[model samples]
Target: MRVVRPVLGAPSWVSLIAGDLDVAQRFYGELLGWDFEHGPERLGPYVSVLADGVPVAGISGVAISAGTGVGWTPFFGVKDAHEAARRGVDRGGTIGVGPVSIDAGRIVIARDPDGASFGLWQGRAAGVGDPPRQTGVPDWIELRTADAFKAALFYGEVLDWDAAERCEVFYEHERVVLRVDGRSVAALRGLDRPASEDAPVETPRWQISFAAPDVDRAAARAVELGGRVVRRPMDTPYGRTTELADVEGGLFSLITPKARPSATAGE
Candidate 1:
């Protein structure tokens, strides 16, 4: 019998917290050509960004927390935010924040069974689709967890996504692919190195990767703009990636593909 496959879902939107909103705006705007759409300045110090007039993501000023640093939060598109949150709770997850409205969408923040936090967006105006390739904004979301299997199962059941495939890649170790419908939405992988003094144990945080036509150029721009390069750009089997941190210590990465299919191409 021939096996039928489900349609892959598109990634909707992603967000991050800025330690310094003004500096982040200037840096991302200059680097990615992102246009900042200031919401009511009184919206408790949050700013939304638009790409080609579409709401791509938002950033809010975050205070220093116990475990989390100033980092990006990526949201997956769901049909109903409340339902997803409820399912997450049923599956041994906890709600971190809202089933509440922010701008055009209703979002609920929840943690998986293994304590990985994620956002579910029932978008009113912004849908989970592929990000613009030309812009140097978030194009992919990856989860680095201690237990990839449990994380995969928790998200699969909670979000109604399916585990697409499990493949071992030499550069990043083994990766378990998850799909919403048939579309590759996110990846779950185990850490290569244990947390130590230099490599502190970062909490289960989402690493948001910005698309760069040239990883070297993006890394250079990040350094020139007062952002520090945490990991120098290097070619891996998957892609060319370099870790970076803003002047205020928010961490993220710039990635240019070396061999993989274009993430925006629905691969």
Candidate 2:
């Protein structure tokens, strides 16, 4: 029998720090059908969220003194956590946590030059588990930053990710593109100054995007399911998108492609 190596180089893993783990678990569980698995070691009061028997995300207990706000921390796959941390620090980033072992992986938390925090995971068991495929679970990660070009260069140099193509949408002021070896792994969006100033700077904190087959239906269902619709569904050249906040107040988005207008039917 051949041992199956875990899937690698996909960007879909993220973490959330919750004031109450039970409440956070309940919200995501009801919303995404995630199963909470508490490790016996109990790495500093955090539990892991698993999907399809694989760890996909985590919920950590919040620290009042640490002044860490509750939000999602996206993790990128890396060959070596220590080396990544060194490069991040050299480029004006700061390490918030260790190249330390937690569960089946070694991860280091670091902030970008602009003070957005993200994680670098060196997998010992499997690489950030498997990609999500169902509704409610995260399917895509988007980084809305001040400088999309700088972010692209920073991540490309650090993680070896390549930009597949670049395009601009009417809704966005700057260019947006999908980055991956070939498949659509993630997106980079340029940020406006006012938005960036009001956003959290310590961590690469941003709204998570959930894959929805139908954008309008998902937005409607989110409201009916106790989530609040922060932004109405709108069509963009890239895709249709809507924003919602979970019952626990965690914000996320749902995206789908726009349909062809009747004016373009003949074309």
Candidate 3:
């Protein structure tokens, strides 16, 4: 487990909001080499995913009363969840859920002005390390929205993210990388219509991507484990990627990153 200094405005933790705790735990445990540590369910049906005896990520159940969608949620670190929620309100963000106290810390679920949902985690939980970036752990996140510039501006005001002006134009969409503390942590992608083609409009969404050394192998493994392969591994400018969905319809991706440039000249 790696220890990381608190980086405000960067993703400190990522959690899946699942419908069934058992199924979610089982699906991820097998795929990500994680084990579950259940939390007090009275507050929320929360569980921490541990890998090699280190807490890596979390899964929580949305109150049936509220009726929220189930998927992965990224939480940014804050000193005080309540105060952060207030600041978000002052900055035009909406607090969708509580600054409720749990055994470990206080948390608030919020939506940025662009209507992208995220979380604010204010206190440190015991024994939780920085989530791993190695193969099999969740390593990256991207927000697919209608307007990348407005989305960046809205979140920049609330979280102080240094969102880049330049967007990498792809065939179907445009992507802008977001940096915090001088490091790229997340991305904002404009979900535009496919080039010169008509397609159904898609709502904005945040997608979670896990890392793999061999994305093709990972995609095959996912199919063997009762998951659906939405897209086969394909080479892109950035990496090799395969889109997949769990048995219960939770969408995620596997990526083999592109090699970084060497500082030394080519041999």
Candidate 4:
């Protein structure tokens, strides 16, 4: 439940690919007080989501289509994407996109056995890693799946990460904490199906959490900026947080960390 910094297995980078670039810029800019700066010219409208002039995540402009999945994707830093995809395939996950080249790094869009999507990145540019979540930065990456242990084992063998610890509050549901080199990197938790819920339910997916300075204030700002607040701000032992969907329907959360009570400050 306590997070100090980012380790190798945790989310090193995160990004959102949506239909509208302008909407992404305004919504995230106001919500996180982010400064969206253009990336390389070839990327075309792709921008770095920065806080205090530090790159935290990315916002890419992708053509809108019925099949497009608009959501924040977590990318884990790896030594090599090609090798990671090879090991991922051996562990039962499928490669959805590439071990393809990009301006900053090589990337592989991968899915776990239970259908949760994640990314693997081997960055070539500097400032790609080091430093963890701070204000206006990505705070956490979590997997929500029905088979918590199954997903844990998949990541363990595929990524050499140990999803080993059970969280304090969600112990009944099995919250597996991912650790890399003795440091907690990310976490996975089992999703509950209400008894009255229908079959053919929505599959589990990885979610992105952004560090916020003020929970209620951010939640309100999101609504004013045409975003939908799925869950209003609520206090927790960790911090105050709320779920929100961007104008493009990409889901993410804004959380105020307990470590810094006033305004925001990251890895």
TM-score list, all predictions: 0.77, 0.73, 0.78, 0.80
- Whose TM-score is higher: candidate 2's or candidate 4's? 4
lDDT of candidate 2 over 1-267, digit per residue (tens): 000121233354677866667777777776566798886442356787776665667777674335676667777666777887887887777899898986557877777777666777776323222233555555566777777678766766566444212211222335444433223435667653444677744224455676567878777766777778877898755477887876666667877633321111110
Q: Tell me the deviation in Å of residue 221 in model 1.
A: 2.5
- Please give the CA lDDT of all the candidate structures: 0.64, 0.61, 0.66, 0.68
* lDDT of model 4, residue 149: 80
Deviation in angstroms for 207 in model 3? Answer: 1.2
Off by over 4 Å in 2: 1-12, 40-43, 52-54, 63-66, 124-132, 162-178, 192-204, 214-227, 257-267
Model 2 is weakest, by summed lDDT over 10 consecutive residues, at: 258-267
Query: Every model's Cα RMSD, please?
Result: 6.2, 7.6, 5.9, 5.5
Q: Taking the tens digit of each residue's C-alpha lDDT, what string does model 1 give over 1-267?
A: 000111212245566766668888988888777887777532247777876665667777653432345667666656778887898899899997889876556777677877766777775322223334555656556788887777767777665654222211122247776433233445778755744768766566567777688888888888898888877899754568888887777778777744333232223
- Which candidate order results from sorting by lDDT in descending order? 4, 3, 1, 2
Give the candidate order by descending TM-score: 4, 3, 1, 2
For model 4, where is the 10-residue window of minimal lDDT? 164-173
